[model samples]
Target: MMKVEPASPQYFRSSSYSSCHDLFYEPDCPKKAKGPMLCVKQPSCSESNFDCSSIFHLQEAQDPSPSMSFKQAVVLVVAVEKLKKQVQTPIHFISDEDLYDLFLNIFEPEPIECETVELLDQPEKRYIYRNQTIEYSIRDIDKKCFLLQKPLGSPRLTAVHLQGPDAKKEVKINMAFYMCPGNPTQEAVVLGIAGENLYLCCTGESPPVLTLETVDKNVLGSMSSSELQPFIFFKSNSGSTCRFESATFPSWYISTSLAENERVKVSQLGQTAFTEFNTSRS
Candidate 1:
């Protein structure tokens, strides 16, 4: 058995309880709220396996302090202890709200902002590569060339001067129109190449329950996109991060699993865990 340490003098204070050393409360408690009165500290296991019986002395506070009555204090202590036990219980399945709450409590999260990049010239036909670049040309399709569109949706409209063979073709693309907020400009609609809709699907199964896939447009028009299941992209503050909060299931985010396939799914917002890469053109 491990040895238990004695209670420190600083942890104890005078009270109307049986003994002055027996009376104690949470340190640094606010003056407005009555501090949770507890008995002298007792040693037990580590914090990971807190021995509440040894730590909490749920005895009445003899002095009738208006801040918290003895009855209220006991109820609070009981509630806290009950919650602690519930947390320790093994969880075979987790609800979206529960998972989100767990993550929110463990890792406080920040709101995501939008990042839109616009192109200077429009191409007759545009192909968005996963590598964060675009291939377009006004001339023959055989002469298609590449242009780096990293940090997609750049606010500035830069001018590109091409000569000789390069000048033979014109590239037209409006990335800003697709990513920009609100209604798209006439130029954007005419020149923009629509991107595939992304989804973080979950079936509550063993593997690959949470996976990333694009919406299949081949389906019959009679069947709505929702019927086929499509997860829409929600913007955030960071440009590189693909932060996905489900509109159907609020607070839940798209997370990647460490499995061999690197499967994806909806989970609580873990600053690091739930963050996935942007599969779409940046």
Candidate 2:
């Protein structure tokens, strides 16, 4: 037997360095040419009872799963406690597959809730309560009436006489107020020429122009509330009269010219233009 000596005291300057013996190599031990590895002499197979060819196998066999690891033991203990609590009757035993599933479930991410998924996929509920087909006549403060005129084969609004010879005929062709859906306050409305497919549209120019553009009422059935915003007007009632301001163009109201028989248009100034109109259901 060879004895190994401790390293020089110069190697340990502070008390932080503890003394430890190198078991792999000794200064006076004989080393085999096995690259940079330190070699140690082994006893014969007969004396040590170790087959050199199967040493690793024998070592593994000696410690073949003597006990479960910390994590495995913890999972087993938890699984047993959960089983004891859940089972109405005494648990006879638990299968290996059940334990594996429980172990996987402990670490696996939970599935998304059904209610949350349904909310994400469900279509938004629309609240459209003003009744779609209600018609009304828009009469200006000056007693001038709003009547549709198609002189150049294009339908446009014109302020006309209320009690003239053609008064009854013009009043019969009153404007229809299609209240826009999804507006809780009932302020937004779509003005369409009664018995015609023409709707009042605001042009997207520098200064928006009001024009009676032809729209398919059938196609409007398929449109969303946001898509109908161009033709929608915000109706604000004051006393006996109400103002129809353009929804697309804020602060702009539907107005007519000062002179009678002139085309009804849009104006930003309430003082200069005739904006207030008294409505009557037809």
Q: Which parts of model 1 have CA positions greater than 4 angstroms off?
A: 1-216, 220-222, 225-230, 237-239, 258-261, 276-282
State, as a TM-score between 0 and 1, how close model 1 is to the true structure: 0.24
Candidate 1 weakest ten by summed lDDT: 183-192
lDDT for 3 in candidate 2 is 16
**Model 2 over residues 80-185: C-alpha lDDT tens digits?**
3433343335657889998999989888867886653335563432424255456777778887887777888977788987675777656323233455444556
Give the clash count for model 1: 18
* Global lDDT of model 1: 0.36
Error of model 2, residue 37, in angstroms: 88
Question: Candidate 2: which pairs clash?
Answer: none
Query: In order, what lDDT does every prediction score?
Result: 0.36, 0.60
